[model samples]
Target chain A: MTQLQGAAPLGATVVAEHGPTDPRDQRPVRGRKKVGIGKVIAWIVMVIILVITIFPFYWMLRTALSSNGALYGNSTSLLPADFSWGGFERVFGLQTVDEAIAQGGSGAKLDFWRYLLNSVVVATCVTVFQVFFSAMAAYAFSRLRWRGRNAVFGLFLLSLMVPVIFTLLPNFLLVRQLGLIDTLLGIMLPSLFMAPFAIFFLRQFFLNVPHEVEEAALVDGASKVRVFFSLIVPMSAAPIATISILTYITSWNDYFWPLMVSYTDDSRVLTVALGAFRAQSPQGGPDWAGLMAATLIAALPMIVLFALFAKRIVNSIGFTGLK
Target chain B: MAITSPGVAHSAPNGRTSVDARRRRPDDTKLALLFILPAVIGLVVFYFWPLARGIWLSFTSWDLLSPSQLIGFANYQRMFADPVFWNAVQVTLWYVVLNIGIQTIVALVIAVLMQRLTQSTFVRSLILAPFLVSNVVAALVFFWILDFQLGIGNQMLEWIGLDRIGFFTSEEWAIPTIALVNVWRHMGYTALLIFAGLQAIPANLYEAARVDGASETRMFTGITLPLLRPILGLVLIISVIGSFQVFDTVSVTTGGGPVNASRVLQVYIYENAFAQFDFGYASALSVAMLAILVVVTFFQYRITRAGQTDLN
Candidate 1:
């Protein structure tokens, strides 16, 4: 029944049932060999749906690898047309202005390397600090018995309902007044310390932790802070790691707030950079090859991360979605 | 002791009364305050303060250059009179309806299929791949694929001897195109959420029904649908609230264009706030959006009874 709530326990059960699970194992269910016509039809439909879901990603790669001039003539080709690394070269500013223009690029340097660095910095700072601070608050809310704890936590939870757009204007103004506008600091400030979701997620985990361990630590003269650091933090590492990954992805993918805060390549993240790149369509139309290359590059980090931590990320989605 | 130790007897072991255990601890209030101070400070300064200031800024007129002057519902009055605002509201609602409707149905089918058939992690990961990328990437990829002249989508249509459709360029197709793009991005994630709920349904129920000679369709309608209501309700509310704030995709693809056909509320508010520098009016619009979401959420909660579960 623990499977009813979270993916973690489900994953654990799977691991126990099948030793050292392989993600590629596509074995059908045991004792379910009665493949009716209906089942075959279902499998066909599922495959078709899967193809539809995955085809665009393939198309993006195909277009990115193709030359811009060749894309117009071979629009429907399955493979890359006039295959070249020119699109990626243009995105990385490896091509000279004339070379870029010759390849149908805007010839305007994208500063993609700078934006990528900016994204790394902003996402890392926001994820590390937000998760840490939220965990501390979660510990207070869940483990400690204190006056006004539930009320304060409830107030934090209520803020979740306040759509982020409602606060955008004021927060933008505040960031500006703090002289953080057009800086990485501005992009990171609003989300730097805590998120209600992070707190709620951690608090739920903390609530289930038996108090006896903490009580034992206290009896041995450890402070509450020490107990939290030494006991709770290590014990709840899984939830903490889960929250960190989620926060990192969110921060990396964030467009709106960063779009408002970041104006130049110095602080502009990949998402905003991609948006700006698309908006500035030179002569004939957008540099399709270059644009696709940049989009793919921008999405690469997250894709790689998802690939590495697919199980953990997938499991956490169940927990987050239900919340 | 009686009042303080209502239900916490387990912690007081080894001849320690609950009151004695409590007395051994340092001041919890001070420790809690210390623990929560950083998050609380951030929440107040960034979230709570901004929320209040946004509400206040709504009632005043500020153009960034001058001091905000009290305008007393002038922004709200202007919004009510503004056709563009109404058009934005309409476009947003239409987009939400399309997004939620299509996303929900597709996700449900996908979820049911995954539950009944194989449980391949590879398949689940593939379904969730689109969601991992940012909206900008999804929009750009789709925009290129769905371009009017040179797009592969149009090329395929022409191959079928059908007239090419202007996906983002035509008003008729802009909202739907944007909606569909987002649907592609979100449906898999939503399906996973529903799939989790489906996992919770007991196999005994199915076996019991099978023994009673119930058909698959009959069991699905009778057991699966009823059991999945709480999850479905929660997913719907989450999806609807998210769909209403559709900004990134539309902003990237159409910029609310082909003539205001996809000018979602967020886009309109952003334009007023940043482009026009009409912060006051933008604040009012945001307040309006917030009110709508709150009311909608309340109604959805009441209608879905999302808080209640049939499992127990």
Candidate 2:
């Protein structure tokens, strides 16, 4: 475990070691005269790649802001021409003109709010349970010396390669047998049990915690559980945050598992709800504006999370040896 | 970050090794068991039991409404004869190859470029942004953008005097198109992994090579490729495993349609179990997938290890 943790930070350490001499640090000032045709080509390729990557989000936002007429009509404006909040309002369950017309007399009885709430509730439960259990297991695997520790840890690691789909059916049956079908608990249960990946990642982080800190706590007569709660977890905040973010993102974005178990608005997450909404469109094609709006709503939390913790998240991903 | 330096942490072990200190404590075994119990129970109930049950289920016929009867090797025999299953296998393999092949190359190129750039944070975040978007939303975005009539993809193609392609509707293009979209969504993540690998290469080695008059191309091929072997293996393993399990995007975009062009194994399993309600056949398919995965991973390990030795 110690060796693994040591291996993990080699990249970070080398990057740090070479910081002062890195060509990147001096490139801006001295690179102008040195820019060859090759350099120019590289930059152009990079920028084009960047544009391709970022353009979809831009297009989604533009479609979200545009009226349904602009998307379907002959105008074909690339940008938002006439701004409209109809899509957003409809998603938020405020009866829009489209909804009123679509339902003929009464407004569309969309359960967007309920779906969003279910997503939130499920994602939160999965994140909390997965992280908490993973931390305990990781601490035990890394810090505690026991008879069967290596064997247990090895089994967990081996299970990491098991494709989740392999277990989906039988797990579904198990959940159904437990009478958890169509409940948020049913949707969340499969993932709420922390997987091998989380344990492995957290174990790497826990191994990095200095032995002396825990030794001191132990020497001072603090119990193992108390020491773990008070000292180990607090010191391992970066990885804890990383796991929390990852777990939350995964739980939030999960579609198939939730779709399998959840049937109604009471348990259906935003992704499944959006999928049903898009599929149930009357004719022609899906409501582009409404779909885009819902996509944005589903995507915004993750975007905001990336904006807030891009560095931390990226570093954790890079340094922890998780893909 | 501060704790990562094991060298520093190792030197000052308070003059008492952890094992020696641990010997004084007798309650540690019980405490450890307590700590690991939840995870252990979770794995048993959620993973191991289900895994065993899935294997057991493959021999039985269960349709949610009726009692399951064990008919040994029946599901596997049917699977071997099923043309749809064969088609699914072919489609899945194609998707995995294209997805991994495209993503690996693109991510490697981007990672190398990212290493040279100064404003990498902005670029990295922008590139990784799509990965955060759920598969459902990603499929929707690409669905609209790749729409035959209203899609911007076809619009741009027409502007360039090429025919508008049916991304999800046509059999020839559907699988490849979905693979491309999957690549686009995940390449950034793969790039970051490769970037970390690039960073870990000691700068002094490149400096020494440059001083010895090695060309940039030679340096990259000789030094970078060999050194990057391990992380590349990791990336390939992750990509292959992930792509093989493709379901969400396929379900949303093609519904395995236009003639089963995009029906990968997961989609096949989903349809059999949920739609057709044939739990036995689905379980058989699931077992086959698991077997294939294990074999593929073993080969991946062997090949990457072989590459490491050849490079050395």
Candidate 3:
């Protein structure tokens, strides 16, 4: 039991069937600490790269804050000189941000609020359905003693490789026939409802759940559904959280389908709206400050989430991909 | 997803099947079906149904504007004969090549750099911020930066001694620009993946290499790189699949460009289905792309799996 203490945290040591019996893995391997020039050089390179990676985002926020008139000015400085809430002012589509909010507009005619609301609705609905169904399917695949399970899973895996383009016309036609165009339901139905990857990922998670626990639940008179929702759901937080974040982000940022299906601003999500805005810009092109502002706003929610859950998100990609 | 044996194989210490569950399972088949009904129905409706429709649609002449003619293989034949489709094919290949090449190199480098960090977790998350910014938003951000006059790239170039480069307008630079934008957004995800693979690896492997007094290059060539084969293969395969389906980015950034330089397969399909309403041709094109992707991905999986080791 003591041997499970130091196996490179998050790279959690494989606790075997013997229930954590390995002594060699139990001792912490304090990795070599660097010193002098090597340490300084490594740190310097790290900082520089971090700056480069983060500079685009920094520039984005700075550009968002820059005045429309001042943006055209040759400014080498990272920080905007003439900073105002002008871009925010423009997004609200009023003389001031407050005035724009008082009206129907969130900040502008097509500011953050409407699009944010659309995104929230789409993402939330997509996540809930995708996760729930994926979980149930995953449970069945992982637990059910059904015939042709391997073949079914293999087919589903093949579905993962089939790109969205292959399914586009068919889905579009289906939606059109159903008269779901320009509806939130249209965008959600094709993708968010059920993804093969979601099933695959959750199945991987479900496979890891020790069978004894579920057996215990079964012995205690729990049905499969009860065991799943009550037992597995609680213990499956890591993978569930991972999938939820993934589904939520993917849904929020979805572009191609939304662009293809929706015609009006009513059903238009952030991606499609931003896409059309780019398409219709004049020869002089899109307003840099305003566009950047809009992009920043659209990206803000996920950014905050990523910042808060960076570890899980990073590890989630690794985890989900590996699964 | 560390799935070992599944939960169904649950057995007691005495090797008897766990009791009480099956005895009480009410209408067993019905209950199982009830639990799985939503998923089964969902797959049939969303996936299987659409796939079947798409396959069937490929067999007929169903242009949105025209009468639904039952023309078998003609759409496929026309696609094969058309140079336009071939151009789209070439652009698609270019996009895939560029995405794989740039993202692989950048991801490897970033992964290596990230591995060197004393604080990898924060850096890993920081690097992955781009992944959250969806294709549309990322493209819009880049679109603004690559605008004809107001573009930051041109603006910066003008400030320097160099001439302002027409990133989007120029045929030569347009495809590369879009590919670069994709690489920028996705490289971090690949890097994170590689880092996870790296982190997952037992430190003793490196320690053993160090005991042998191996050089850093030798250590990487011997231990780190080889160990990362499975994950690297995954990243490569996914990048290839994703690159071929490059749509939202290109559509948002260049709209298939000034002279069709950036017109990838998905973009071409979109152009056919949505833009031109040639559903027959579009269906044929989609079928062709899917066939190619399936074949390519199969080989990729085989090769990658072949290279995989039982190191973990």
Candidate 4:
């Protein structure tokens, strides 16, 4: 600012008259050359902090790449001495994973494949079913005027307000009655099978949709079903996608219910599988490398997904919830 | 907006066919009903049924097996009488308070820092990493970090001049440690929310304050704090709700131990339902928890809303 051609004549009286609030207070003054050195210092400090934030992720990938031999050596190497695909190979292959499991060398050999499959299955199923139910409910509540509509919506809101555990007892019993215990469905069926938050998010999105779109379709002699299927559905894709991502992540990481339901590795999701693995802690001899490797394997999927879609997730929350 | 009258609207007599079209037609009520039915039925079967059964079971004296026998509030009476029940409540209340307080303050500070690193997208994303991990993963990760033996927490303590803290072990630090882990896992996400709220406040407001010769800290107190009440209140409420229903960390880390010193309401319910097979007792405990949360949350909402109106 001081160096600008027409900015100032370098007198206190004139400078105070124009930019007296001290343009350097807090908000960065764009196009100002005087702040260049300060900005560089700030950038360096920020980069250092950013490194601290990203180091854990680097460590996870590093441990995943390290071989069993390199791991057991316990050498304090930031970079791997000998990298191998053994852990991931073992995680993905049933036979390799099975032999390891049969021996049970380091506690219970986790069938990581089974857990991953279970997680994928449960997450996909719950996300699909939950989105369908919530969209329907939200559309109905928001658009349809029927007997006891407000009352029913009130019940939905009340249910949302309460902690979900209030209904856990009944849900457990219901699942038990249906013979779903120890099944993938059992873990996925509780909070999600009917999620109020989904309904809430979806309805808000649906309400923001225009009445004219459907009315215009109807005016053109288009059937209601055709209109909804064609227009409303396409328009609401963003909210539905948001709900799907949120629901999938939630179902992916669900713990206690799965722990209570699944008796063995065949039925357990990654969360419970990892949990049971950690429970059988190698107390006497700590296998830090293996434990870290296993944790990385279980955690990698969600971390990658989150990193890629973080902006979408945050913006999605702002979008879906605000309406 | 709508003039709904079934009588004297139209008569489908001879030559009244076209005339009927002139009268008001039925609204798109049927389509709306169709839209809402899927969610309604799902909730009814999965949520409402279970909720009713749970509430009813609170009055019965039954276990996992056999039909529930009505016992006229015996479970509630017992819950009220038991000292352990109160202990769990106290710990839970403390957990809720401490978790909300610490998380709110830290999240606010972090949000402020994040806003400062406006030019750095990596730092913003970095701050949000822990939030991306699920609650269980966060708890498990922290559990590993706080492991008494080879844990990073203890390692850090050794690196520092201080003695090792028993984090999730010794009765004294167990609950607080759980709270800290909870905060660490959640702070990034909460801070992200608060940071959004802060960013949404127009830059011109702060500039105006600055032009009025307000100091940075004063501008924060007068402008930022006043504007951030809604988001802060939300963070406070949600954190409280999350803490009240806390079961994952208690189960994974301490096993509610050093003698259930860190036991929360959910854990208490878990023990009753699973260990004792006292589903009736568990139901009663859950109902009590529901009532307490509703009352507390309602009060908090009212308080915050009232403060907002008063400030206005």
- Scored by DockQ, the top model is 2
What does candidate 1's lDDT look like per residue over A75-94, in tens digits? 88899999999989988899
CAPRI-style class, candidate 1: acceptable
The total of clashing pairs for model 1 equals: 0
Q: Of models 1 and 4, which has the larger lDDT?
A: 1
TM-score of chain B of each: 0.93, 0.92, 0.91, 0.87
lDDT of each: 0.84, 0.78, 0.72, 0.67
Highest TM-score against the true fold, candidate? 1
What lDDT score goes with residue A282 in model 3? 35
Tens digits of lDDT, candidate 1, B3-53: 111112233344643453488545888989999999998889989999999
lDDT of 4 by residue, A1-323 (tens): 11112321221111111111222343452233354565567567656645644555565566556654554453346785377555455444433544433322254455787888898998899989888877777767765545777788778776666577886778888888889889987887775546887876666656656665655666677765676568767998876877788888878877877877888776888877766666775434433444456667667777888877665565543332211
| Candidate 1 off by > 4 Å | A1-33, B1-21
Q: Between candidates 2 and 3, which one is better according to lDDT? A: 2
User: For residue B252, what is the lDDT in candidate 4?
Assistant: 71
Question: What is the per-residue lDDT of model 3 for residues A157-256, given as tens digits with 9 covering 90 to 100?
Answer: 7666557776778888889889999999998887655778788777766776777798788877777778888888888887788788888888888888
Candidate 3, residue A51: CA error in Å?
Answer: 2.1
DockQ of each: 0.42, 0.45, 0.40, 0.22
lDDT of each residue in B1-312, candidate 3, tens digit only: 221222123334424555565554344445555556677776677777778888788778776766778789999889989888899899888878887898888788777766665434676777888888888877777776667676666777877878877887899888888888888898888876676566556677667667878877887777677666766777677678777888888887788877788888888888888777788788888889989988988899788772354463
Estimated TM-score per prediction? Answer: 0.93, 0.91, 0.88, 0.83
Which residue window of length 10 is worst by lDDT in model 1 chain A?
A11-20
TM-score (2 decimals) of chain A in model 3: 0.82
